[model samples]
Structure formats: structure tokens, C-alpha cells
Target: MTQFSKNIVSVSLWITVVILFGSLCNGGKILVVPVEGSHWVNMDILIKALHGQGHSIDVIRTYNSWFVKENSTYYKSITIPNTKGMDEEFVDDMLFKMINYERGKSQLSAVQLYSYVFKAIHKTHEMICQLITNIFESAEILKTLKEKQYDLMLTDPSWGAGILLAHELKLPMVYNVRWTATGEGHFDVAPSPMSYIPITGSGNTDKMNFFQRVKNAFFYLLMDIQNSRFNLPLYQTFCDKYFHPPVSFYELLQGADIWLMRVDFVFEFPRPTMPNIIYIGGFQCKPAKALPHDLEDFMQGSGEHGVIIMSLGSFISALPDDFTEEIATAFARLPQKVIWRYTGKRPSTLGNNTLLVDWMPQTDLLGHPKTKVFVAHGGTNGVQEALYHGIPVVGIPFFFDQYDNLLRLQERGGAKILSISTLNKNTLHAAIQEVINEPSYRLSMQRLSHLHRDKPVKPLDNALFWIEFVMRHKGAAHLRTESYKLPWYSYYSVDVAVTLFAVVLIFTLSIFLTVRYMCVKCCSRKRKTE
Candidate 1:
């Protein structure tokens, strides 16, 4: 009991010291949540930095992992609701379903693949999941306002209910946008890559790859269905009660006071940006740590051949057989050892040089001295991990803004992008070779790593400071944009512009008909009188 007390006291003192430092810095009640998968890891970092600064943190958990430090207070809004066991169950079920689905397939179909995904999210029966997340998350944010009384709420742009609740409670909110390609359509914001930026017009005009375009269409279609079933219902209720109608889709992010992109200029494409969109790249890092045991063994055992680390990220880590087979075929030709993080049955054709595991210590592996190349699906957290360790990449971007990330990496000469559709042994082998053999790739990557790590006060410091500043100042209103206040039709000018065009066309046609009618009538009267 005494030991526990001492530990608590030690933590309290540490918090006091950080708080003292932070008070000299800024003030606010801080609430953080991440509904998007492993992006929660970034939230963990924000929580630590804020807690260290001695600010009260209301960490609302919506996923499996929560690593709040000792003596820190937290609230769980809606959990992915799956305990670790539940997560395992989800994976196991998904893997089995995907495997069987692929069993009879000759080639992979996008519709079938995504259908399986929809089945998985629904199977989780996320009704209670969403409600719990919304209620708890809202409760935590409201509680913080009521207790420490927040000046602002720091949350992801689309983190479950954080966005909605912030608007509901009328709190100042800072939006942490993790990727860059979250472009104009996303609340008419400027370009910021998830982990990188890209060249762009007023908004990003770069066309997506086939897979990405298809995925975008698919998501949009799904959201359209959801908008009707769920969003419309909720929107109507709020409008009826509060007299403030919710803006349509793509107008959501504009509601926040600020949107902070967790990305870097060095690694991203150049693009026009708004003052409201702040770039806080590589915000999800801690001081470099030593490599883990399994990673060290994998690195040292590979010798000069080095290792190719492949991960589809947390979302697609469970390799469907068709995707898995495609990867297996690619690695078979490579002379280098491939350490693949695949949660699937190993293909019989897989070579001795390739190692398949259910999971990987990705950060530890990246940090190892012998690690050569990283093949990723190009998510923000994974990009940060790769850049942090100076590992050049082979980006097999599957969906969303991953294609943008691939573009940035390629522009820097630090990586290559292989279309997942076109990826096979010959293409992947060449990409791996080009990334590894090229000294420029290594040099470029190291330079980026240095730039990413050189920020003053660190991202954690910035996030913590902002949190406290919000509490003290009641949400730093000067930072927010009033874009969200505009209605969707007005914002897009779709109704006004379209209506005007239609009216003009009709007016011109009506004048032409009137003139013709007058001519005919005058001629008929002259003939009758004659």
C-alpha cells in the first residue's frame, strides 16, 4: 500500500512539474479521442504530453488500445467495444470469411472484397458501439467543460462523435487532420496529406488511381445510403429541436475552429492551403527506443541480404488469400528475406526467404539497423514510422489518401508506388531493388527523418499547450473558421448556379417562341383582311 502510495505521489509530482511548465505555456481542459483504428496511437501520445504538462485530460476511448499514464484521468465514450479477445474474434472471423470467399475466385473482385468488409463492420453490431461512443465521448467533453470547463476540445476531424458533440455543446474545437489529401470536399479545406502533402490547385485536383477511385466511389455510395438512413434522421431531429440544421456531407470538418494536419512538408506534395489548416506533422512520436527481441533477431539473422518488411497496416493486415497470393508470388522472386506481417494461412508457394507472422512489432523492426525496405499501404502512422527510422518504401496503396502518400514518397526518391492491381513478382522485385540499391533513397529518407524530428517543443508539447490554452481562454476562437455556418447548397453554389443557368436557357427559348408566334398571327390577320 505504501509502495503504491509512493508511486502515486511520484506521478502527482511529475504531473505538477509538467503542469507548472504548461501553465507558463498555455491552458485548457483537454479531451481526445480516435475512432479511426490504430490512429488511436497518435491520441495516446497527445494524452501523455498533455498529462505530463499537468492539465486534466479526458481521453475518450473508441478502440481497443488505451495507454493513459498512471494517475491520469480518462473517459471512454464508445469503445470499438471489443476487448482484446473481441478484436481477435473479429480478425478470426474476418480471416475465415475472406479465405472462403477467395477459395473459388480466379481473380480478385473489388465489390466482393469490400462486401466482406461491410459484413465485418456490421457483424461487430456497432449500434451500441456508436451510441456508447457518442454518449460517453459527449459526456466526457461536456464533463470537462463543466468541471475544468474546457475552452477547446482537441479531436480528430472525423473521430466518431467528437465532431458532432463539439458542435452540439458549442465548444471551441481544434481538428487534428492526420492526412494531407483530405482535400476541399472535406469541408472545403486546403490540401494536407495524412503524412505528406501534394501539389494541387485551389483544392486537390489530382486524379486518383484506379483502385483509389473505385474505393472512393464505393465509400461515397455507402455514405449516401447512410446519409439517408442515419444522417438524415439525426439531421432532421437536430434541425427540428435546435433550429440549426446540420450541413450536408463534406461540410463536416469546416465546423471546427482549426484543422491540424499531422503531416510534413518535406515528405508531402506542394499545395494551396488555408490559414485554418495547421500542419503538425509527425506529432505521434516518442523518443527513439531500443529494438525488441524478435525484431533484433530478424534483423541480425538476415545478414547482408537484409529484410523487406511488408505490412498492409492494421485494417488489411488479415491478408485475403488473393491478395496474400499476389504478395507471395512477388516475394518468391526476391533474393532478399521478406518479413511479412500476414494474418492468414501461408501460401505453399512461399519461398524459404519469406517469413509470415500473424503480427509484427513494426516500430521495433523499422528502427533496426539491418532493415532495408518497407512495403506499406501508406497510412499516416505507418508513414511516420517508416520516416522516423529512415526506411525507404514500396507503397502498395490500397485506398483513400494512400495514393497521395505514395506520390509524395516517390517525389522524394525515397520510395516507389506499385498499383496493387498491377503488382506481381516482376514489378515488386524491381521496386524493392530500386529502393534498396539506390543510395539517394537512403540519403533522402535520412534527411526527412532529421527534419521530422527537429520541431521545437515537440508535437506533444504543442497539443498539450493548445489543450490548456483552450481551457483557460474558452477555446481560442480566433483560430476557428466560420465556413461551417454556410448551408450546403450555398456553399457549393449548386442550387443557385444551376437554377440561374436553367432560368436563362428557358427565357431565351421563350422569347424565340413569342417572336415566331407574333409573326404567324400578323400574317394570318393580313390574309383574312385581304
Candidate 2:
């Protein structure tokens, strides 16, 4: 045969092999229902990774989605039209109220604050429930979704809408979870001891005194009440209407095949975990890429003192004018150059050393050699990225789980937490200076980074393996625990404990009665003889 013919035949064989291999790895369809804002940021990373693996992804987004765009190269979008969704305005309003309350500028009492939060959560959940209701009621959307025949449903369980959809379609479910509808995801599927495992909003660490433990218990109770009163009832209404044989929303949430938990023990306190819960924390983080020309020049200008980067995550672009002034004044006192991500009015106290921008390349800046300390809002993505890059943090937490996330780093000696209520120029500057000047903070964080990085496979790769494993096996039922199906009493063994106690009591009572009868007979005979 001619050399040209041989080359053609060899190339054809290689192409055929490649096609077969791709077919074997591909052809799995995933229906993703993700939460908005930072949760969407995490979900987007996973979606892109999944698409690279040749899986077809269909994402569900509300018409008012703040981040999940209608158009994307990696995934097809399924937009639901909802007039009232959790948009930026809603978040900003909440933040404003929360800040006012925290700073003692509002007339809201503690009770009022609790009431406001409850109402806000209730309203949000009601909207989500309605959105899910719309999906179910729409015959065309349901038909299209059912026709897609997705292999699995991958979702963030921060909202329970995805859980409802997964159950409705009878598809295996996987969670990209840190928080669930009720609280943190671990509490649902794992053994979370209230004695040491601190509740989300509680400022206590794993080590707690008696009073701290009491506070933790109270926080847990408050969360449970919120779940029962605010979150569940709204979703339960839908459950009653649509489900056959009736299943609680919590049940559907706990019955997922896999939970790709977004935190590892390196960042999280040591707590009990279940078999199916995979820690894929820092999966969204990567080695630093080249910064834009302008950013690189700024980094270079920082010189030996290094650069300090600050961001308040995706949601809060601007704080109150007074708060910004306080922060800017603090930045002025620092020797290191500052890159502050702000959209507020320029603070008059701003110094020549500080640079203000509407946005920043956050992860890349953290990864830079010249980067010294991170001034962050303590969002999970920012926290994980800082840990991934071995950078210490000066955390200024606002609302939600941000405080708890920062507290974890503080407990680990990698970060310092400053309260927004008490944050002034002096406090902010002190916190930043302490983190910068102290070598221990950087050492502790670098140690954590080493531990986080010391693994056989990358976290993203591990997550993908488990995701595809579910698709391959139809579902990971074997790894899933049956404890979720058990009632609360049964799960805690309360029934068994009660039963055993009753049996022991009955046995002891019978013996005592028999002995008493004998004693009475003997006494009667002795009296007659006398």
C-alpha cells in the first residue's frame, strides 16, 4: 500500500477511537437549579467543569436572576418568569435594615429585628414556593423538562425549589451545598452535636463553655423555629398539593444521592460527617492567572510592603457613606497599597495610597506574591480562595453566615474578625495592621493551605467523579444513609430507649409486689399465733 493511504487509514482509526471514548464519557444530561449571587458563582464553576466533561447542562433561572444569565456557552438556560424574585434590590434593602439595626441607628428592638428577619425569610420562601408552583402548573414547561430525560439533578439546596423539582421528576439528586433551607447542610444528614458544633449565627467556636453551649442551643432552637415557622410551611403547602402519599420537603432534601459539601475540615471545625457527603471546598479556586496591565502595575507599585485587597463579595457594592469614610480613613493610615472594591461615593478621607474600583480580580490578586492580607466580607468563596492561596484575612462581616465563616478562620489563627457595629478607622486599621505585621497569622493560613492542598486528587476532580458516578450507577443509593427515612424519634433511638425503660420498670414492679404479698401472709400468721 502507498504511504499516503497508510497515513489516511491510521488517522481514521485514531479518530474512530476518540469518538468512541468521548461517547462513553459523554451523553449524560444534568438539570441544574441553582441559587443566585455567590451560590450561583460556585454553581457556574461546576457547570463549566461539567460541560467540559461533555455533559449537557440545562440551568433553571428566574427572569430576575441577578447573576445566572439567560445566555451562556456551557449550558442551556431555562428561564422562569417570576415578577417577585430575590433580586438585588431586595438584598440591598435587607442589608440596609440590617446595618441600621446593627449600628443602633434604627428604632428596631431585638424583637423587631427578629420579626423583620422572619418576615423577610418567609416572603422569600413564599416567592420560591410560588416559582416552583409555576413550574409544576405549567403543562408545557413540565412536558419539556420531563422529555429531556436528565440523568441527574444537581442543585444548591440553599433553597428547596431544586429539591422539589428533583423529586417531581424522580431523578437522582446531588447537592452543591454548604447551607440548606433549614440551616447548614451537615445538620440534616450528619450527627451534629449541639454541645460543640456551633450554630450558624452564633459567634462561639467548637470549644464552648457552659454559657456558650447554652447560647449555641438557643441559636439552634431559633433556627429550628425559623425553619418550621418561616421556611417549611410555605414549601409544605406545595408538598400537600402536588405530592402523592405526601413527603415533607425536608425528606426530599435529605434523600439526595450525594452532597458535595462546599467546605473541608481544614476550614471547618471538626464535626461528624456522613458517607455520602463529599467535601469539595476550594474547588472553585485555581492557581493565579496574569492580572490585567493596570492591576499588575498597581501590584508592582506596592513594593516590599505588599498590597492589601478588599472586597465585600458580589452583593454589597456600597456601604453607608459614613461607613465607607471610616474604612477609607483606616486605609489611609496603612503603609501598604490598598485596592478597595467600592461603588459608593468617593470618601473624602481617601488617601493617595488607596485605589478604588467598582470591581476586582479577587482570586488572582490573592494568589499574587505581593498580596499581603485580605480585607473581606467573609463570604465563603472569598474565605476559601484566601485559604487556597495561603493569605491571611481581616474579616469585616455583615449579615448572614458571613460572621460564622470569619469566626472559623479566627479560631484557626488564620484571620481576625472585626464587628461592623464597632468598626471605626482605628479598629479597622488595628485589625489590618495586626494581620499584616504578625507572622503567625500568615504562617497559620499557609499551614492550612498545605493541608487543604495535600490530597490525592483535586477537589473539583473528586466532585466530578462522584457526579458521574451517580450518573453511571443510576444513583448512589448504597452510599446514602437510610437515617433520613426514619422519624426523628427513631433516628435518635428515643423509641428504643423508652421501650427498654418501660420493660425494666415493669419487671421491678412485679418483683416488689410478689415480695409484699409474701410479707403480708407471714405477718397475718404471726399475729394469729400471738
Candidate 3:
């Protein structure tokens, strides 16, 4: 080769290296609007992955967000000012009240459910509005965000302000929800057939009777009405006041690049889905690590009877005294050792067989060889972990999707649902015994665990690939469906049905008139002849 050609090649290679290095060093700038509550912890895996991959993340959250332990150079967190009613104490108190309300009503009627939901919804709206208002009011913060030019806005749709922020900044959004997306009123993201897919926490399944379908339909209708009447108006008002060209609030949801829902068909029933929806269930969960020495010793102490881990998630871990007493009594009867997560006052009736801790390493415990079953409230994350480890369960569901989650597990023969309102020592013990005695429960969970693990790609990688894909393609609009483009009547084919009926009616009338005319003409001719 000539000297000139060799020199040219070397120069080109160096230039290419410089460009590629720069691109790798400066990845996409992402803006996240995460929940300030316990739910914030759920985003830890995804956010941490993005950071580790060198993506710059700027999170706008409430003050003292539990999401951050220490400040990170890779990530920037800006706390919204004037935020109130977002403290752990407040959260605990509200949850306690909700538990009491459910206990008062053994089973919630539609009216009672609506009443509780309405109050909760109303309160949530106020807090969201206030936080949003704070963000807009913070001139320095708003200016900084605009100047940085974020590539994407990843948010939880439960917070309406996040959607508004995405719109105002002209950034594409991707929803990251902890639960099954449909239960959280993310109907536009995916199609959930009322005939089969039951509402979460409804204690109904995909296989419903005719009356059950009607009831489920009514429940969904009521929720929609509530959203439109209360939630939508508030969101619209915020947008109209803050945004430049105010668009329909719901339209933005349709325009999302993707929806990362924590749902898997292995545990859930198969249903209709859209192209933009991605089920990254159990992404947050990892292979459980070694238990603490103390925990290991405790599990080993159970011997042949095995240990049952009881942690009702963060929301309801601080259960009432009476409930704890009954649970304690039930545990005392069992040969198995119990580890319960409790945060409030120690129950006087707590038995020697039970070990109470402020926080329990639930996933690690579930994975332990000595751990036989999980007694939980059926939170999505907890249920996924239990199912992942192939553990049978005693589900004492309290509220929200807890009931529905347990009911599904029960149907699969891997769990038993015990109502919080009607729970007693005898009932709890029997429920636990039934699951422990049945070998089918363990077998079912093992099958499900295998199915869950036998996936083509790791869930985190799947999530990251789509996220980076959106950044590269500028929202990947091609993946979105045309369904969102249609109006309500057209989407449901109501207009098509009505138009067809009109055409058929007109055709029938025309035929009838022609027949009558012919008959009349024939009769007149016959009379003249006579």
C-alpha cells in the first residue's frame, strides 16, 4: 500500500474513535417524575440501571424523597417547593385509616368502594396540583429544566402533573407503573376486555359469569366517571394555566412512546394488547442474596416444619393490635416459625414462635431453602417475588389490588385468600394449613416460576433497549396504534353500528313502498276491467 493511503486510513480511524467516544460519554438526558411515596422504591432498579449505563437523570420529586440516600454525580434531583402531605407519617396514618375502613365493612359494596375511592382521589388531586403548582412557580427550576433539553420524560401517570410537565416541555413520555396498568386507570395504554380481564382488587377473575361481567363493567364505568369528573378537569386546568398550546389531557396518554407495566401473562390471564405496551414484570426483582446470619439461624431453627415469612408490604405492615393478636395466636399453633414485619406498637399477644422485625428481607427470605410459605398482603412486587421463588402463600389481603392478586393466586392453587375483616385465629391457621398440606400449591408455583424465568431476554435489558430506542428514533411513533386516533364512538364502532342500522331501515322502507305501489296499480286496473 502507498504511504498516502496508510496515513489517510489512520487519520480516519482516529476521527471515528473521537466521535464514538463522545457519543458514549454523553448519553441521553432523561427527566423522571417519580412518586414521592413508598412506590418510589419500585423505580430504583430502572433508574440505577440508566445511571450505571451513563445516562444523565434529572428527577423532580418532593422534598426528602426516599428515592435518594446520598447525592449522585450522575443524577440530579430537584425537590419541588411548597409540597405538603407527602411525609411518611402522613402516609402511615392514611393507610391505617384505610385499613380500619375496610375492617368496618367486611366486603365493600360498589357505593362504599366509590365513597372511599372518591375521598382518596380528591385528596390525591389536591396534593398533585399543589406539587405541580410549586414546580411551575419555581422559576429557577423550570428555567434550568428547559435549558438542559431533556430527551425523554419517564413518569408515573398517577401523578397528573408528570404528564403535564412532559407536554409543557414537548418531551415524549413513557409510563412506569408498579401494578397492572389497567387497575391504575391506564385504559388508553392497553386494551383490557371487561369480559375476561377483571378489575384489580375486585376479587373477580377473567372467567366471570354474566352477572359478574355486568358488575365489572359497572365498576369500570364508575371509575371512568370519577376520573373524568374529578381528575381530568384538574389536569386540564393545570395545563391550560401553564402550557402554551393546551392540548387535551387524555390525548397525551395516547401519544406516549411506550408503557412499562409490571404485569406478566405467566401470573396474569392473556388479554388484548397494543404495540406500545411492554410487560416488564419482575424487573425490579433479582435472585435473592444470602440472608443475614441472624435470619439464617432463625430459618434453620424451624427445622422440618419450615418458616413462614409474613410481611404485608410497606402500606399495611403497621396493622392494628387485634389483627396482630389473631395472627400471633395462629402462628403459635403452627409448628412453623414466623417472621412478621411490624412497625407500630408491639402486640401484647405476640407469641414466642413469632419473630417481629421493623423490616424483613422478604425476597431473600422467600428464596431461602427453609422458607416454606409467604403470608402477605399481595402487593404486586411481593407477589412477583413469592411466585419467582415458587413459594405457596397465605394471602391476607387488605385493600387496593391486594384482594384481586390473592384471588388470582388462589385460583392457580398456589395460595389462599383470608379476608382481613373476617380473619381470626382458627381461620388464619386453617388457611395456612390448607396451602402447606397441598403439594399441588407448591407444584403450581414451581411451574409458574419456571415460566417466568424462561424468557428470551432479561426484563431490564428489554426496558433499556426500548428506552434507548425511543431516544434514537425520537419517540418511535411507528410502534403506536391508530386506535388512540379514533374518537370514543368510532373506537367502540358505535357510529358504524348506528350508520348500518340506518341504511338497512331506509332500504326496507323503499322496498315496502314499491310493493304497495304495485299492489295499488294492479287493484285499480282490475276494477276498471270489471
Over the stretch 330-387, how does candidate 2's per-residue lDDT look in tens digits? 9999999999998878999999999999988899999999999999999999999999
Clashing pairs in 3: none
Cα lDDT of all candidates, in order? 0.63, 0.92, 0.79
> TM-score: which is higher, 2 or 3?
2
| lDDT string, candidate 3, 1-530, tens digits | 89999999999999999876765676899998876544666776688898776788988776655445436666788767567635665556656666666678336564675586677757867787888888788888789889999999988776677787888788988878743212353466667788988865455788999999988888888767777787778877877787766677777756778888777888777788777888888887788899889989988899999988988786654667787788889998999999988787787877888999998777888898888889888888899889899999889776667777777788887888887667889999998888888899999998889999999998888898888888877797888887777898998899999999999999999999999999999999999999
**TM-score-based ranking:** 2, 3, 1
Every model's TM-score:
0.67, 0.96, 0.91
Top TM-score hit: 2
Candidate 2 similarity to native, TM-score: 0.96
Query: Which candidate number would show the highest lDDT if scored against the true structure?
Result: 2
What residue runs in model 1 are displaced by over 4 Å at the alpha carbon?
1-28, 61-151, 179-187, 191-253, 322-335, 346-359, 450-457, 487-530
Ranking by lDDT: 2, 3, 1
Sum up the clashes in candidate 1. 26
lDDT string for model 1 (359-453, tens) is: 77788778777789999988878887888888898898755467667667777778788875577677887888898998899888898888878
Query: What CA RMSD would you report for each candidate?
Result: 8.5, 1.9, 4.2
